[model samples]
Target: MRTHYRFGHEWQVQARPDAVRALLEDVAGYGAWWPGLRVLADASTPSRRAARLEVRAPLGYRIRFTLTESSVDRHELRALLRGDLEGWCMWRVVATRGGSRVVFAQEVEARSRLLRLASPLLHHRLAGQHAALLGAAADGMRRALADGEGAPGQRVGAP
Candidate 1:
């Protein structure tokens, strides 16, 4: 059995796109900010940056994936996700009146049979957990950017 998942999340960062991109590109430090996110490897460079990340929910299911950069744009970063999950994820950052608008979109399917089978009852919870994690990440980024790079902002979109 296979279960497909598509997620779209957007939030406001009280910083410039460059600051936000800098934080996002430094994937190795995700664990220091984003809870439960572990970066197994960081293959970032001055021109292109990406990483292999392990995502675990409180439900104890682990999804490991590598994000390989697939785009060459400055304001947008797209990645081909490969590993326990298969799909693509992207980050688009644009300047907003106050700061920057960050949009994150991901689509992937579960490779674990147990996870696929449990999706019917657990999808909502899983999405909620994902939302909370990103929300916290946004908060962390704001705090990190508080030193004149940015401030704090609110999270939009839904679970």
Candidate 2:
């Protein structure tokens, strides 16, 4: 049997689809807007990427995952999980009337028994965090599109 764990959030970004897609593809920019994500390793190139990340939620832990695949189709950018987590995290950008609708979805399997046992509780918290992170991303994208630089708000590094 296959076990499934998923969490996602949708937000309207005041930017074009291209702009939103650019920001999503730029993994290094994640630490600037995505809270609780401490970027341990940066994405080397536009094609292949990997990072050692310290995630605070779902029982504080660190995992180094390689971005096995990252590609854009029209407006959506898909990222496949490798190394630490076995799953997929996708970002969909749809053109709306005024801007772009962005959705962040992650479907991952528990890598350990502890993670599996805490799945129910962690799911709820992760859902909330995802929503918040998306909101922040939207704001950052808006600013970047307006100023020509994807400048994200200051974030303190993980201790």
- The alpha-carbon lDDT assigned to residue 25 of candidate 2 equals 69
The count of residue-pair clashes in candidate 2 stands at 0
Q: Across residues 25-141, which tens digit of lDDT does each residue of candidate 2 receive?
A: 677667676665667777566556555555544345544565544666786777777654678888888888766788878887766555555556666664565466556656765
TM-score (all chains, Cα) for each model? 0.81, 0.69
What are the per-model numbers of colliding residue pairs?
0, 0
How close to the true structure is residue 92 of candidate 2, measured as C-alpha lDDT? 89
Computed on alpha carbons, the lDDT of every model, listed in order, comes to 0.76, 0.63
Can you write out model 1's per-residue Cα lDDT over 41-75, one digit (the tens) per residue?
88676666678889877667787887777784788
Pairs in clash, predicted candidate 1: none
Residue 102: error of model 2 in Å?
Answer: 0.7
Candidate 1 has its poorest 10 consecutive residues by lDDT at 150-159
